[model samples]
Target: MLNAAETRCDALIVLADVDHVIHVPLPNFTFQRSIDLQGILKSFLRKALVERTGQIERWDRGTWESFLSPLWKCVVEPVMDALAFSTPGDLSRIFWCPTGPFVFLPIHAAGLYDTKYSAPGHKVFDFVVSSYVPTLSILAPSRNIYVAHNDDFRLLAVRQPPTDGRRLSRLPGVHTELKHIKEVITNSGSACATFLEPSVGTVEEVLGLMNEADWVHFACHGIQDAKNPIDSGLCLANERRLKISDIIGLSRSRGGLAFLSACQTATGDEGLSDEAIHIAAGMLFAGYAGVIGTMWSISDTLAPIVARDMYEHLFRNGTRPDYREAAWALHEAIGRVRESGEVSFNEWVPFIHVGL
Candidate 1:
């Protein structure tokens, strides 16, 4: 960690340097149950992703708040206390690096959301703007780079529909999503050039655009290849794919932010969870300062709304999009969705912010 200087507004500007704290909570306490923390972690993901996922999406309040309540009690809250983050907003910015099966856990979403007796400031997001890294070593390089003051914030936004002969589910909301994003960036006096299906949505075009742009976004169907991590990629037009290998080749000096609205963009291979080889992390390796991804699948209908709110906050009719505000903008957007009470727990928890 390094000392960060404050801006004229007194807000801490995020640095390219990695200033972080890591806490492995298992050794800090003795468990009354026979099960070890490792076993508990294994069960938690299995239950959430495979066993009782339907209950989490459709059950009553008990099931709705199940993972969050216990996670706060056992993992996140204890870490907060050890760090002496005892009040709301004690830390303005924080990032999580969950290893092994814990990568599947929503540490940012930890806290009792439905319990009547829970304190107002019990949630992790209540304390700081949360981001994530698979490991400290991943962010200890040339990331968190920002566009220069003289440069215009050029964004390359893409929306991929189902290509011919592929049975991929369509995201009908992406039309409105790209429209909203374009409107926001245009008002900010920036470029939000978009490419949709049946146009220049090919891999070659996208990669070229990404190289020339400061910001990039993808709203499409994502494919994760557990057998071979490099094969994992997002769907593009003309049956072409943007594989993880492709993203790894990108090292842009002007890289800023990448918003991945596709499913499972943050999910790593189950067999190699400790490595954290996933699309979102790939974007970080490609030199983007901040990345937005989902731990699992998200609602097709709600994707546009989430995108709209986040870009609105990031731009705010300003002259440019502050790539530094990516994490805070994400936190604010997810908070609005969660507090709306119109979405299921599944709909809101999958959204995650990664990197600085």
Candidate 2:
């Protein structure tokens, strides 16, 4: 294995499946059986650690084969044999491997991989936490790591029907909401201009403005071709599909943030990293400063509310909020809705922040 000193990158990014951690738990078994289960868990952890950390010097054959081997034999293997059969995609995808002290993984793995794993959402965080901490701590003790997690990562069906159901105008003050978010963005005084697409807008129109604007906001439906996920894209005026490739080709802009108010615009299908082209991610990989996206289907009322709060956090109050902060602001805004008793908690809490 390569040592951290020999590695070239400054930080590591982990793609975690939050659903897995929230839904799966270690099997309930006799003390001896649980101990045996631990061993198998360790094996998978070791492999993921090696691949993700890219550290070659941490490898210790005898340490792994002898001391650690039995640890899993006694604790993790049994849990795997009993529960693996019933685990859902969300639970199965939970990864607890720790890369560095500075590594930033999705929430599920981040909290789980830490020593002080007893935090909010601790139960779901346990599977990952119990799985990775011991091994990685021994391998890399001097790196910095961070985790991003939220309850909204889970799949939730939209509860309310779209008001207009067909036309953008029927969306209950869609223009006003767009204007508010755009103004909040402009108030940041970042020289970024915002545009609201009514329907299927063209790539040429986007490219023309994106070339000069420091920020771009797309408050429209972004469809992911479930069959061919990368072919998925945002819908513009006229029912045109703006494929993932089209979004990736934009030129660079300084401190640019593309707020994709589109659904599941930040996901990738399993088995291929190249196919994991999220509109927000593609923009980031193509050199945008950051991107904010949703994880699954969202409530129409909630999305605009979240966007309004995010833009307010970013452009209003002179706060220079980053992508994460902006996303949180949106969450906070929705929390207020639940607090005020205007709508239930299920109404306006459907957004997540995705970025580098």
Error of 1 at 154 (Å): 1.0
Best by TM-score: 1
Off by over 4 Å in 1: 1-60, 89-91, 138-142, 163-166
The models' CA-based lDDT, in order, is 0.71, 0.42
What is candidate 1's lDDT per residue for 1-356, written digit by digit as tens?
A: 11111211111123345375342334322332112433554454445532111233333456547646766776667666665677885656776676555666677877877667456588888777878887776555455445456766678888875455346655667788888898887777755565544466667778888998888889887888889987898888765789999998985774588999987898888787768899998888887778999877777777888899999998885767777788888888888887788887777878989887
Among these predictions, the greatest lDDT belongs to 1
With candidate 2 superimposed using the best TM-score fit, by how many Å does residue 244's alpha carbon deviate from the native?
A: 0.6
Model 2 C-alpha lDDT versus the unseen true structure: 0.42
Error of 2 at 178 (Å): 0.4
Quote each prediction's TM-score: 0.83, 0.51
Clashing residue pairs, backbone N/CA/C < 3 A, model 1: none
Q: Tell me the tens digit of each residue's lDDT in model 2 across 1-356.
A: 00011223111222233223222222332334322433343343335321111121232333333333332332233333334423322233222332222111122211121236334332222232221121222223222222222211111011111334343222343455576765665566543443533542466876666665555676666676656756777766565667777766766543455777665565454334222445655665555554666544445555667667766765555534444344345445654664575553223322444442
CA error at residue 296 for candidate 1, angstroms = 0.7
Per-residue lDDT value at 341 in model 2:
58
Cα error of candidate 2 at position 155, Å: 30
